[model samples]
Target chain A: MGLAKRIIPCLDVDNGRVVKGVQFVDIRDAGDPVEIAKRYDQQGADELTFLDITATHDNRDTIVHVVEAVASQVFIPLTVGGGIRQLADIRRMLNAGADKVGINSAAISNPEFVREAAEKFGSQCIVVAIDAKRVSDQDEADKWEIFTHGGRKPTGIDAVEWAKKMVTYGGGEILLTSMDRDGTKSGFDLALTRAVSQAVNVPVIASGGVGELQDLTDGVKLGEADAVLAASIFHFGEHTVGEAKQQMARQGIEVRL
Target chain B: MRHVAVIDYGMGNLRSVSKALETVSESAEIHITSDPKHILDADHIVFPGVGAMRDCVSELRRLGLDDVIREASQTKPFLGICLGMQALLSYSEENNGVTALDIVPGQVRHFDTQRERSGNDFKVPHMGWNEVRQNISHPLWQKIDDASRFYFVHSFYVDPTDAGVIAGTSRYQHEFSAALSQENVFAVQFHPEKSQSAGLQLLKNFLNWDGQS
Candidate 1:
């Protein structure tokens, strides 16, 4: 393994503008995905992940064009997720200059889809994006379960165990997001990250709940995640990638500074 | 007019490379042309790629840009990025067979998984930012310090046969050649355009480089 711990900036693109509506709803214009992606790349971001929040409803061509436009400007590795369900979608994204394709709902519906896509495009190209939310139970045995449809529906599946299964099913990497921590400006769920990182053999990118620079460091050092991803912090000019990396280095974490 | 012809064989992110060059040069002309004449006529040439090594080499040969590149490297400044750098080597271990390029002496081999395994479960493709330790002094490293960070995204690396040509080295799981220079021919496995400040400095250094006549 030669890859370093990536510091990725995620973008939720809705109609070509980066938007952050509550729980992925009533999305308003945040900014252009291309402009935001270029800004992150310019700030020394390791990689960029673009989630087409409305791709499923808009169709494949729209996403492909957006990806093409983004790829034309940015040179770093770009991973496109959301509404990538079929082989054709994967191929289209790849052809449009996406280095990796992330699947979430499709993999949940069909576990074998991971293996099938990995077999077709190689494991390096497939990324499994897991959206999980913590559930409380009176039985005291309740745990976090996987959520689908933009974290709208619960699959009643244990996220930790499901992550392990995802890797076994040929997921090259895991992008774990905590629905509870998302957009909270509190911090990342270190426990959830550690559990998923321990369960998967491939690289695990800890997503959701990156309030400050220390959260990123804790996510990498304490959570043992291969990468740390944040959205609002970066999009809202809270912190640049270089600033976060400098903080990580100060905390005795090995980063490319 | 000082023009920089960026060889675009339909395999690279040339726009970023061109943008980086434009930032550094006062009169940098970025021409994404496959024509051999444009490559031969340019003041400098930058070969940029992010796709398969074999595909790029084959495309270069198909376009008869192989001879053009070979001729251009003799007098003009030539820099290869990522897969373009791999194509500058003698051969690559991709596509289940050895496709020879004969640009450099050594063969480009896939990263040794057995030898370069990290304890924390590192990923392949080596995507992201990493530091490059300067091994030899060259015009490219004019203002760059030791262990300068650079962005890399590749599965293969160059093994220069001549030690004198190696300019900088980086460690992933093990030490590997990150930047190489042999006369006017320079290559880097990392993408300087994507590397931000450090990368911009490198591009500026290259633009101001007075080594190649």
Candidate 2:
């Protein structure tokens, strides 16, 4: 009746190469971004997200080349993240063929930057990625706080309220990641996902902890996420994007097959 | 080699559009230009953009492509996408009120965003893939199945005064015009370059299309 729920396979790219694990991607020359991107597109991935994990500033420009190569061939939406702090950085990524550029620490450091970016580029291309973990110790803690530096630093900003503010500042979408369950292989923080999703009118992309196929459906049906993103499962060849769609379809969650 | 001009008015991304055209076009030279001469000299015209309509129209007028677009739509295989499609309307509700190219009698309005009575969570900007039902048969739809899902990421939808020009419709809050056609022009709200197989086919059809009904 409406838009289909999207499945995005995120590739952590460092200096122009996708790296999840050394042994996971040996089949097709492992780290080649173009090859991995092409394979995902062929498997019917709705979109592709390249999280630039490169450390140095000079090496950061490498992601732009990676985005350009993949975007030239793959005809789906491409979003690039990591080290996007200024307007020039956003412009560089967009000009290099990225459909959207994600803002993480920069967005938290200066909230006005979100408004400026939205006013300049339009909110459609601005995505604010939030890393959050539960603050309360009680079972299924209801209170969560924002974390920066990949969940190492806590900002004490309430996750739900921050999501609303980011959207108000003209962020088109929110990439909410549950730091508590990121590598646990358990599932998305459904409680955290629902709280933020209900508080905001924009689309929420659930990230961080997806171990299997059912977790994808749970994020949509239970967590109320507009899209689900994962890296390891798809990167290791445990499941194809096609298979994920079929699984969600079986669960009666609307997906593009 | 056929020359195709992608009108760039300093708004959104034209890189993907040109790249996609280059990928599908057979011996056709794709040129991304804002100049009037390049656009006027081209055999095919592809107008594409994103962002606000006020800026889109202002920039089009600033670059003087408004007249060029109007002129090209009459005698060439012209295609418009996203903000480019909205710019063809008479006016848009964005930025208070902004007048458009007036090629098609229509008004672009922001999504009502009125939560459906059935309790469906319909969001604005309507970002994602949605099914587009073909309202009329057109050459640009060649090799593409009807009601196929296409990538869309816009907050406003077009309402043409003349129903005949509406080539396609898609339901978001309610059914809205997703594609429009007039004589030699075809425009869409969705991004064909980003719609994968279905989108690629639409672009391929446009490249091979002869300016005929």
Candidate 3:
């Protein structure tokens, strides 16, 4: 059958607790990762992503434990990102119960690592996360530059070109996040998302700036993204995963409703 | 409690598969191991695989688990996922062609890159959730709905020489075997572990199955 569009709820965890302060019903006092993950699984989330914002050696073990605890209960594929630099780190994440590891800054520092990781672990598990922003300079009219270190440092590299190169280097999926629209609640940068999605043969997950259910639908429809990833919208309880899936399903976009 | 052993050939993600099986059944003890004896002794055997073919085949050969798997599939309730399912076929086109176990008398075929349906492009690795249509009744499918969506991330699919063994079909560029059953052995191309509720139901069914059909 035709592949269904996915609605992914991103959880940004700092240290041990969810950084966004996502509260689980009754279990709010516990703040247990497993409990929160179980809630999402029951809500019919196509997938769940855990971004360890701490990304420090001190918190790596804690995050690994979190991954293990959540993975043991949640039946969906879980992707863990942040602080993943080398093959050993990727191995640690995978062995710690992550289905896929999203690599961003490390990929920029050394693109060869992408090829190496993809070679060791299948391409299906290597996700290259690209944070991009529109370049408004006179030099380039239609250009988006890549950013690193949590969208603080801007790299002169063209976003679309880098995406194509990542695919060539064997990256299985691209998590394209529009930094300009990230927390704006305006919606996904459809132009940016569409450009990257068209450039890569692998699945593209559009992240950032999802305010409502329609934004999730737009990610698949206008942006041509295979999946949509939002943090604040899902984490803050602004909307439920079921509501997003239902909206997509009503729009004739195949979602796990 | 029933003991279920998931064969680990040092490839793919076994954590999700093992955990999902654990979540589905409280009566079954799931173990992920490469040891042949443990695999052979389990009440049920699951062969989960991913990554490249050459590496997968080589690891299976290195561990000598191929023989163990062959022996186990003949007697106990056996289940295979993705590359695990592909390895059962006679041959696979991945990695410029590699020899497989030939358990199901079939060839693993790659999706045509140039093929696209309704003008929409057909991407390889087929990574996403897709609807699976049940073609025949099987123990593993008990309590699961007819057209449930399951997560899949694979490029090549099995083309069994004997269609009678095909238990389920899913459309990508065209219809392909989503699940295959032969006697006591059942295998699927999609990751039931990542398929949510329907998947949990299928795994629960497997836990309770007697390996008769």
lDDT of 3 at B44: 93
Give one digit per residue, the lDDT tens place, for model 1 in B1-213.
777888987764466677667766776777888899989998888888766666677888899988888898778878878777888888788767567567778878776544323365345556567788888787787777778778776667788787777888888767889988888888899888767667777887776665462
Worst 10 residues of 1 chain A by lDDT: A21-30
Listed per candidate, the RMSD to the true structure in angstroms reads 5.0, 1.4, 1.8
lDDT tens digits, residue span A169-257, model 3: 98999999999899999999998999898777788999989888899899899999988998777766778899888888888987777
lDDT of 2 at B94: 93
- What local lDDT does model 2 show for residue A150? 77
For model 3 the TM-score comes to: 0.96
Query: Which residue pairs collide in model 3, if any?
Result: A1-B170, A1-B171
Clashes of each: 0, 0, 2
Q: Which sections of candidate 2 miss by over 4 Å?
A: A22-27, A139-141, B114-118
Per-residue lDDT of candidate 3, residues B26-127 (tens digit): 888999999988998999999998788889999999999889999998999898899999999899999999999989999999887665432344777788
lDDT, candidate 1, at A210: 88
Report the C-alpha lDDT of model 2 over A73-187, residue by residue, as the tens digit: 9999999989999999999999988988899999888999999999999999999999999989787548999988778889989999999999999999999999999988899
- Candidate 1 segments whose C-alpha is farther than 4 A from its true place: A1-4, A21-44, A55-79, A84-103, A106-127, A132-146, A153-173, A184-186, A195-202, A234-243, B114-118, B208-213
**Each prediction's TM-score versus the true structure:** 0.79, 0.98, 0.96
If you assessed candidate 3 against the hidden native complex, which CAPRI class would it receive? medium
Instruction: Give residue B189's error in model 1 in angstroms.
Output: 0.5
Give the winner by lDDT: 1 or 3: 3
Residue A108, candidate 1: how far off, in angstroms?
5.6
